[model samples]
Target chain A: MSKKVVVIYSGGMDSFTVLHKAMQQGLTPYALTFDYGQRHIKEIEVAREVCEELGVHHKVIDISAINQLIGGSSLTDSSIDVAQGHYQQESMKSTVVPNRNMILLSLAIGYAVSLGAEQVYYGAHSGDHEIYPDCRPIFVEKMNDVAAVANYEKVEIFSPYLNNNKSGILKDGLAMGLDYSKTWTCYNGREKACGKCGSCVERLEAFAANGLKDPIAYEDT
Target chain B: MSKKVVVIYSGGMDSFTVLHKAMQQGLTPYALTFDYGQRHIKEIEVAREVCEELGVHHKVIDISAINQLIGGSSLTDSSIDVAQGHYQQESMKSTVVPNRNMILLSLAIGYAVSLGAEQVYYGAHSGDHEIYPDCRPIFVEKMNDVAAVANYEKVEIFSPYLNNNKSGILKDGLAMGLDYSKTWTCYNGREKACGKCGSCVERLEAFAANGLKDPIAYEDT
Candidate 1:
């Protein structure tokens, strides 16, 4: 039996790799993007484009009301600076969005149940564990239990990229022969990838570790 | 020191009772409501008024985007029938709202943590457990684990009415001298409470079992 999976496609390299790997593994990928009142609307724009490019059924859900209701996140607040530098090095307080993964995954789970999809996929990586507690395995387990009891729909939450590093994801994308050029990773709202931003730094480092040149253009290399 | 607690206040009979009880128990009741794109905006109106009546700091967050993203609940959907009947006799399908309490509680946990409030109060009685899986102790236990692991905070998710029947809530509310006249419970968008709605039926039954009359007008009875 063929299984349909919904990947929380964020137009980032990590999610891009997950989507590509899903297709290679003979699974039909239904991509979901969130317009969660992020300062970087460019991410949404990029996510929409990638879904179209990949010819996958995609959904963009609005959860900005959550930001309006629950503020103080650097990602959601204009006054707060998006933390730059290594993800592990950045203080938890600087980048933490407070239950962001929990909310996003919950929305994904709801959509998956509606679509009758077998699984919900997210691109939570190992490197984010120190800062974002919701990105950890424990959160995934606890929320899966909550999702199960709440929906009562025998559903499973998948975080395939949770234990993986940037190099591993980059390698997986390369192994799947994915065109990673279409992906965007910069958190800043700039034309070119600001190499200074943590996202760009991770992407560049991953590609470099894999001995491949990243196709995305950088502004401050 | 007055212990701070966040009450999931909907200005409805049960939530209002819970908020009043929380305050009566010597805790500072912080009223929190969600504008989740429900058809009956009147409930929100009642919620605001009830908060004012209690003289507590009230906040209504716009989770409308989340609702719009989800879209298939009887409470939120105009297309669906607000199934009216006895709570225990209703079809299980009628009870499920796709992880609502879990989602709401999770959001509350986030907000509570931000405010440094360690307790979150929601009113879910035994009569509700007949249809709502979220009203069960199992879900609450799992959610507590999620809150702990996600935020590393000692946030407690409390459903004071969990083991209590409707009659029990009525008793508690009456003991606390809750202003039932100010509380709204009808799902129908009408001036008087629509006794046909499951909520109204439960309310009526609770008051009847408690040997008291519900202090609200009903269109049906």
Candidate 2:
């Protein structure tokens, strides 16, 4: 029997790659997605479709009840417009969801414990460290400490891409012959990806850095 | 304006006392309760009543969606019986919800960050150190480290009763003239508390240590 890992699959390029990487490592991956009332809820649908195609056990937890409690972010609050231009722009700070990674990881640890899985994987790459504090290596390390003793069964938080850039992650996924179209990166929830948003721009840059055109459709391009 | 604090109010004796402690400290208290599909869901209702009577801002977050992901504990799984006898007994280990405090504290920290509150409080005490790993001081300290960096707004995890036993907590509540009947601690979800259960037995012991009769009615009493 293969070891089981709980992957935090957000239907984004990073997590989509993370999920596939878990499978490639011979670990049975259980995808855990959270619907935290984000503006880009389209990612949840994308995640569900990919999970179905891969025959993976997936759970899209609806934590929208917490919307009222964790609002004020462009990702969750309708009033705040999603930031455009480079992902490292100061305006991108508005995209930060308060304590989001910690909350998601905590719940994932609980699920892993319930399933007797020893590891929980999330995609927190180096690029996010500039804008999101929770994505920094230190934050993940501290959370790892809590996860170690949080339950009777110790669960390790495995962020394999913590030091990798988005381009590096994309390069690895391409090497695995993984299709990126199944993932969504645009912060704006629209029929076509808004290439202007910080997320979409960063994703496009990553694909360009890999000397390849992104398979997903873009409204601005 | 007084500073604000988010209290993880479970409608148990410990949290009920913690909620009042926040008010007594002259800080505005926002009560946060989670409906995690526990067998003793009656406690949620009791929490609501106490918050309503106190005119405190309260939210009952329904996270029952994760019930399937976090089953196997007697608290959340119907297949398991509520453990009887002293809470320190080995059988009481079944009552441990996997990583329960980390999940709860994470959400509380998110809510606190959203409200611009600097502090998040819970009712973890020394009595639970024997059976629950998440209730220990080390777990709370590590969670606090994550909470501080999880968001741009620094939030603190404050477990004021971490070193105190249940009797000490009860003494504090009694000194504040708190009404004990408003909080529910029975493991069984019956109309009357099953006095033989670990939680009830512990509560009874706390009252006895205080040399006072408990105000709540029990099945075996």
DockQ of each: 0.64, 0.82
Query: Fraction of true contacts reproduced, model 1?
Result: 0.59
True contacts kept of each: 0.59, 0.84
Q: Which residue pairs come into collision in candidate 2?
A: none
Q: What lDDT tens digits, residue by residue, belong to model 2 across residues B47-154?
A: 999999899999999887777678778888889988889988898888888788888888889899889899998999999997899999989888888887878888
Q: Residues A1-221, candidate 1: write the lDDT tens digits.
A: 56889898988888888887777778888898888777787777888998887789888887777775468877778898877787767443666776677677777777776667768878888877777788888888887887777665756788778888888888877887888888888878788888876777788889899998999888856
Over 4 Å off in model 2, which ranges? Answer: none
Model 1, TM vs. native? 0.95
What is the per-residue lDDT of model 1 for residues B45-135, given as tens digits with 9 covering 90 to 100?
Answer: 9889877866898889877766544677788878887787877675536646666776788778777877779989999877777588878
Q: Write the per-residue lDDT of candidate 2 for residues A85-143, one digit (tens) a residue.
A: 99888999988888899889999999999898999999999999989999999999999
Distance from true position, residue A44, model 1, in Å?
1.0
Best by lDDT: 2
The TM-score values for the models, in the order shown, are 0.95, 0.97
